[model samples]
Target: MKRYYQQEEDIGLFQRMQQDDPLAFEEIYNRYFLKLSNTAFKRLQDREMTEEIVQELFVNLWLKRHRLPELKQPESYLQTLLRNSVIDWFRARARQDGFAAEMLAQPDRQIVNATEQHILYADLQQAYESTIGQLPDKCRQVYALHQQGRSVADIADQLQIAPKTVESHLLKAHQTLRHVLKDYSAVAVALFNFVF
Candidate 1:
């Protein structure tokens, strides 16, 4: 009975996709890609390979849309399928004897460069902090609360200011940061690192 209901839902979604419903594709992609990518990454341990596998999975999924009814839990099924594919790829490379050896012969440049990038990131971060420190007191406070993950409503309530005022302060803070960091590519990276 549960299988029947799931099949019906799958059919509905598949039909919507076939009709070129953008939201359906977006929903399906978002709902599965992260989990599937994580599963692939865990197995492959190569970021580029994992990304390629996940992208290929999405492309294959769309191409095989008519077969959606065969899936039990589409997301889980895709993850398992990707994991098996990664394992098979490793096995095939192992059978080729020198393939793994050649891959291992290359230095892990990305890991090595990441250390220097981290130091540069820290420097840019300090610069951003110093610039933010120069904001007007209320703007600094509002931006600080925002950086702490406080919502505008929560910040307004805590600071005893109107929400519009909190938003205005945040906007002013962002404008200031943009102006201060306009000359550096590191500025965007710094802001993203700080925000996230």
Candidate 2:
């Protein structure tokens, strides 16, 4: 069995590497590390990642030495490994950048949404309060009772008014409020449906 190797035209070094010869592995690493780094740097154009890929390859070569026997074309095999590693690094970086972009934009959308909701609610409350105060006393009473989930018949019975009168009061209240809140009609109508 091949137990040691020198770098001169020797398939013996690969066989020795399969037998876990540290000397043969050292020679191979020293011979190829610079070439691998250069190849990777040229493709990736990033210093830190190029160094990392080369180091990982050497570390993997040591750990998976038993598999080295299958590598008849050592130079081609090393290039293939480096090429695949660069592709993987690029894909990972793209996904990370997309996620970071979303995260960066998220706060802006949330702030705008919250501010709009606050302003809309404020406008709706002001219109509702001011218009209700302008309502005739009977109409304001009917509208308040209707918003509190009371049936028209129940409100009429409690207020000693006819059911038809109660409905008329509610209709007048809706029309007057809609007119008073013309500028905020769309938003107020949305909220009004939930209330009355």
Q: Which candidate is the best by TM-score?
A: 2
lDDT by residue (90-191, candidate 2, tens digit) is: 657755878446646798876776698688878788778988998999899999887765668889999999999999999999899768777774533444
User: Candidates' TM-scores?
Assistant: 0.41, 0.46
In Å, residue 4's CA in model 1 sits off its true spot by 29
Task: In angstroms, give how far residue 180 of model 2 lies from its true place.
Answer: 68
Model 1 stretches with alpha carbons more than 4 Å out? 1-112, 186-191, 194-196
lDDT of 1 by residue, 38-85 (tens): 766755668998898788877877777656665444544564567556
Question: CA lDDT of 25 in candidate 2?
Answer: 79
Inter-residue clash pairs, candidate 1:
none
State the displacement of the C-alpha of residue 88, model 2, in Å, after optimal TM-score superposition: 0.8
- Which regions in candidate 2 have their CA more than 4 angstroms from the true location? 1-4, 99-196
